[model samples]
Target chain A: MSINKDTVKYTAALGRIELSEKEIEHFTGQLDKILDYVHKLKKVDVSKLAPTSHVLEMKNVYRDDKVKPSLPVDEVMKNAPARERNLFKVGKIIE
Target chain B: MELNRLSAHELMGLLDKGDISHVDICNSIIDSIDKKDKSLNAIVNFDKGKVLERANAQKGLPVFIKDNICVKDELTTCSSNILKGFRPPYNATVIEKLLNRNAILMGKTNMDEFAFGSSTETSCYGTTKNPWDLERIPGGSSGGSAACVAADEAIWALGSDTGGSVRQPAGLCGVVGLKPTYGRVSRYGLIAFASSLDQIGTLTKDTEDAAILLKIISGHDPMDSTSVDRPVPDYAKLIKKDIKGLKLGIPKEYFIEGMDKEVKQSVLDAIKKLESLGAACENISLPHTEYAVAVYYLVATAEASSNLARFDGVQYGLRSSQAKGVIDMHKKTRGEGFGDEAKRRIILGAFALSSGYYDAYYLRALKVRTLIKKDFEDAFKKYDAIITPTSPTPAFKIGEKTEDPLTMYLCDIFTISANLAGIPGVSMPCGFTKSNLPVGLQILGKAFDEETILRIAYNYEQGTEWSKRKPGI
Candidate 1:
């Protein structure tokens, strides 16, 4: 499918990334080229096929409900940009 | 003999025999890096005092690891700017395993940002040059690991392969790199690129070093749900057996017309050598081979888009002071934090998985992935292993394919199929191009059948001088 500046804006939004006008123009061209290439897969007849999400058989992995020690608060908060009284502080989630 | 020049296993032997102390080995390696790394940039960060302290233990053996794998209190950046200055509080399972073995955690090596590129050029820290020729690109995102091993900067290194990140670089740098079966090595601490396709592997000076390192690191971990529960075999012992009469499949599609003439000839010569050594080579077909790269980008980028969401400037990594709201914070942080290639992947992945296009792109790619795996299964019914060129060509000059995203993606052509099939594969030095660039002969095996692949690589390595010649850098 053909991609444009609008496509880059939408993708950047969905990806939680902000881009400048220049990046949008640049990605508009790059994404258009890549999508065209990846579209090559459309020709394969997969009508009777089932999608393989993972290479291995994955099942619900269960473990005994036990308390495992967690990383100490000091170390856990080591990289937090904003924090307070043993909690990570962030911009307000609610309006 | 140069102390840094010895393989990991050789160092182990010397340590056992009391011929040298770990301190002496550690110093030799540290000095080699001090001398060589300024030009090579194989290692990104290291503190000699801490590394030397760790090396003082009787069993302490220095290992330079890819920056993507967590080593407690060390920066596990995946060579991305987002993770700049961020050190993990805990060790990945493999790191713990190595620490227990007294593996000296020397330092972290460089890689493509978030393991996104075939060449090390995408690293925020800068490209790691090939040891053989300083001007040529080192095949990556495991470039740093392979280059360091080739230059003898460290005994060996661990590199995670999603799409030939391990094997391709191993081939170009003239080192031994093994992309073990998907679940053989736990991914607990490996920062994800493509979860299902990603595997932590070994890069070393030779095939035996790969085997020994694999033995020390391979096993199940309750921490990693995807880790296989099967008993770990004695890989060191398994590679000792003769490879005579073993059947090897040569997929005709891999030697595509117009591929680099020199690279194709190198692999063809390798096939002849294996035949002379009594290993049977047969022509085989994996009909869906061409679609592997297309399928891999869909699956890998989609997984990467999801995995990298954790870096949203919420808890760790770079945050934006410009953000006025929580959503703005995430957007600005990722925008500023990630490199260009990473942003491109996130955008493509987000587009592929978007509501309207999911089935046409992501879903169809998954089905094609199944077909690719089926090819291996069908071939293995007759052949014991498969062989091909690890990369279509030897190391290209730095920035050669960076301008075109599609061209860069093509670098992983022969290697991506193994990851899609969840099989074990390795690239060993087969021969050199007339221009002196190293070419890798890839050997692939069925899931959890690394022993066979390792055996073929070992047999080929022992019989050839390709892996023996050191990079003159």
Candidate 2:
């Protein structure tokens, strides 16, 4: 139930965030305190209760599969850090 | 004429009477923001020329938008370094509605990065000072919206509430903050924080202004599936209904130990005021209240981890120059881009939702969330509304709780449950502490029942003089 610096680092890596050793140690201590506080939920017996992921009772929202006007290529690419004519450019994905 | 200090409805009256033009009101607020914002730092992105241009083109009251909400081609950085220069290509549903009503688009205000912190200090741009006392914090992540309204820099503003983001800050800054029912407003163009808990709300000079602004923005949109296809009420008119014979619940769990004595007394006084106005009050219990903060952090951060995954260096925002590969690019970009609190939440969230731990953390928290929602549902069946303090204390000093993240997380103790239950809540200036900082009284209503809370807030606001006072900036 306790987290160490390695676990913190591993979790950060899984979340796609690279943390320094200092950050890993810092988060290890902080997350322990937070998770300790959260451990109080273990006492509440919720065995028969259903988990409420969302408050509203929503059904599958179906929309007509019509061809809708989309954002222009230039406007969508405007915020891209690196881009080609119509596609976002990124670092090489494969060797 | 000090038009900046006037509420939106008051300005509307003047504009209708030919006593003032939209340009005149815009100029007044622009002047006030120019003079006061340097000291307060409430507004992060403001252009007088753009505001006046909107005023000239659209004859409506100028409303400042929190930076998280997109405004079409305007820089919509959520007070974070990662989103520097990132402008959304379209307007939020609320923005579209406001524009359709001829409302002038005031500039963007500051907030916690990705709406992550309870205090505005976590913002990458710099902290927004509480107008009441510059040394103290403005309750956030809607701190800038509340501060601007309190200081007359904005007539009204749009702020998204995840936990107590909108209401707590409004209470701290001596303004009115109203968070409608979760599905009441569309979240189409709002930058995602926690998808389920996020609800766009208002910070305004008074309850009437809150109601008016809420009316303009509250409606279902085809873009947001979660938004209910229900008819939007005319809240401005509905709020005027008398609270006679209305039943109010006073939840004892909220008045816990370590709470500020003045805040408790102010809320107690507000209850007395409600009783005197013919609304009956009775003690009630929301037993699951103690676990709300724990449940919220789990649910909110878990969703945040997923929502924020989109910030990788591919499509938008800051991309690191030194990244060697795609995976390395995402890691380096997020590592360098996000602030400390954001990283903390993201890591904590990933740990909770990681395999083997998911059932113990996220799933258990969701079950507890149901109990919390039932607490209100059970209360609302007997009482028309539930009342409590918006925050446990008046605005704390800037650096007071910054060192202890747990202490800062506990600051939203009283306000987080409303979001957990997906109910409507409002924080209005009920009284002030001895040092003159504002104390907010919160009223919680049933799901999709913003009218009851807004009605109670409206009547209480009308019977009180606290909303009349302004920060002496």
Candidate 3:
């Protein structure tokens, strides 16, 4: 239940966030402490309880398939870091 | 009298009587911001010209918005470098509602980066200093909103609370803060922190203003499917109703060892004040309260890690220039963009939801979350509301608990349970400590029952002069 440096590095990778050596070391300690604290949840007998992913019991909210005016193309792309015409530009995906 | 110092309700009275124009209010606020914000760092983005222009057109009250809430074409950064210059293409539902009512969009306030921290120190714009004592923090992620309101730099503000982001800051700043019922306010455009837990709340000079702002923002919106399709109450009207004969539950778990003595005394005094005003109070148990922080961190961070995945260099927001591949781009951009606390949370969340740990951490937290919600349900079956201190202590020194994340997390021990339960809660000033820092008294109500908590807060506010005492910064 304790976090180690390898766990920190692996988790950071999964989250797509790069971590420095210092950050990994720092987080290893902090996350270990936090995980150790949260380990208290193991004491509760929640065997019969359902997990509450959401507070409200909502069903799949469907909407009519209708065409509606949306934000202008320029407005949508206004904040894009790199764009060409109406398309978002990104780093090459394939070799 | 300075128009900025008056409550929104008071300003509305002046505006109605033709004694003060909206422009006058804007100018007065401009003066206040000019005078106080230098020391406070409460407001992150403000253009006096834009505020005055918006005021010239709108006849409604001026309302400050938290930086996290998107205002179309405005710099809605969430106080993070990742969102630097990333203006939203559309307005949040609450922002639209305010504009539709002709309310002036005053400016954006500072916050904990992506509403991630207890203190406002994590913000890219720099920490917002507490008005009571500049050396201390303005309890945060909604610190800017609370600080501005307390210092009168803002008439009122909107802040999103996942785990006391609104009420805690409001408490520390000596302003009234109310977190509406989960589905009460539309979250259509609020930058997602934790989808299940995040609820937009109000920070204002008084409970009446909180009630007024909540009324304008609460209600169903087709854009947010989670918004309850129920009629919004006339909170201003409901707030006037007395809390006579109302039964209040005070959970013993909230008053624990190592809590500030002054804070405990203040909350107890508030309970007595409520009793003297005809509301019956007694001790109640919410045994699962001890597990709220654990559950909240797991649930909130899991959602945040997922929600924040959208910022991965493909679309808007900060993208790294030094990357060879798209995957590398994401890692580099985020590593450089996020602050220390944010990185810690993102990694912890990823670890919890990872293959081997999901059951023990994230899933178990969710199961415990059910118990937490059940505790409130059990309490509400008998009591009209639950009362507790908003925070374990008043504002602490700016760097007091920064180095230790656990101690900082403990700061929210009293406020996190309300979010876990999806109930409405409000924090209002009840008394001040020996050092003159304000102590907040929180009132928790049943689901979709904002009216009750606001009513109790209003009544409590009426019995005390705490809300009237502004910080002399």
Candidate 4:
């Protein structure tokens, strides 16, 4: 149940966050505590139980697939930190 | 009139009678915000000209919306740096309803970044101090909404409740906060947290105000697939004071060892008052109550991990200047946009939902969630409503539990069960702790039966003096 420093670093990388060494140490302890507490779930006899993802029983309630008016491209792009020619500008995707 | 003190219903009445113009209400609110918000930090954004224009032709009442909800041209940050300047082009269904009713949009209230924390302390703008005590934390991620109402900054405010974000802070700050059934209010404009558990609700000064606000906003919306199609009830007509034959269940599980003794006594006294008013009280067992905190973190964080993934820099929000490519842009933007608690939850949630760990964490927590819901259903079948202390204690000092995630998660134990069951619940002031902090009593009812819960809360509030006590702030 112990999460080593390397695992913590890997997880933080996957989550796109940079953690300080102190934070990694602190999180390792905190995550261990949480995982230890959640370990109690393993004792429960849920073999016959179905995993319930949503409390409500309804599913697939969808709207009609119809085109509707959308905001003007200029209005949508008004808040973008960087943009060019009506497109949101981001760093190039591939080298 | 000082805009802060009037309840939404009172303001609406004044507007309907032409006694106060919408322009006047909007101006008064803006003036009040300019004067009082320096210390409270409750409001994150204000659009005075637009608000005045929207208020000019119709009624004279102003409304506050949580920052997470989209309001056409207004900023919708969810109090996170990631979407710092983002303005959603479309109005959410709830906003549409409010505009249709001639309610003026005053501004957006602050919250925990991405609605990730219980205390508003985690907000990117800064913490919203509890109006009652300057140094204490306001209950959050709807802390600003609750604090604003408590301070009379706005007549009424809209807040999203995902794991008691609205109700818990309302309890701590001494305001009326309701977490409607999951689909009771439309989610079309609410920034998603845990989607299945998120619902837009109201935080106001009294039950009557909450009733009127709920009436205006509750209904089906074609844009939100999960919005329930149930007929909206006449909430005002259902506000009867009759609790004579009602059965109220006191969940034995909620009175845990670490609970503040004053809060426990306050809850007991509230129950006694309910008894004197002719309601019967009984001790009930929700055996799975002990597992609520663990179950909540697992499910809420798992969903949050997925919902927040959509915030990568390319879509909308603050993008990092250090990016050399799209992947770098996504990584740097997320790293810089999210606050610490949000990053922690996303990482923890990602771990929980990972391929190898799904069965032990996500799936198992789902089974436990069912048991928690079953406990409430079984109790409701035997009683009319369930009562518990909204929080184990009242408002803590701003930095008290920031370092301890488990302790912070435990703060929502009593409130999370109702969310797990998709039931309606409310938190109202019952008494004050020895330190003068407010304690709240939670009244939980069956799904879609908000009237019963509100009735019980209103009756209790009427019989007590706690709701009348305000923070000197």
- Candidate 1: the clashing residue pairs are none
Per-residue lDDT of B280-376 in model 4, one digit per residue for the tens? 9999899988787788888998999889888887767877888788877777788788877888888788888877788889989999888888888
Q: Clashing pairs in model 3?
A: none
Q: Write the per-residue lDDT of candidate 3 for residues B346-439, one digit (tens) a residue.
A: 8888888989899999999999999999999999999999999999999999988988998999899999999998999999999999898999
Using lDDT as the yardstick, the better of models 1 and 3 is 3
- What's the chain B TM-score of candidate 4? 0.97
**Once superposed on the true structure, which residue ranges of model 2 sit more than 4 Å away at CA?**
none
DockQ of 1: 0.81
TM-score of each: 0.99, 0.99, 0.99, 0.96
Q: DockQ ranking from best to worst?
A: 2, 3, 1, 4
The candidate, 3 or 4, that scores higher on TM-score is 3
lDDT of 2 by residue, B1-473 (tens): 89999998998899899999999998899899889999899999887778877788888888899999999999999998889899998999999999999988888999989998877999988999999999998989999999999999989999999999999999999999999999999999999999999999999998888888888998889999999999988888999999999999999999999899999999999999999999999998999999999999999999999999999988888999989989999999999999999999998888889998999999999999999999999999999999999999899999898767888999999999999999999999999999999999999998888888989998998898999999999
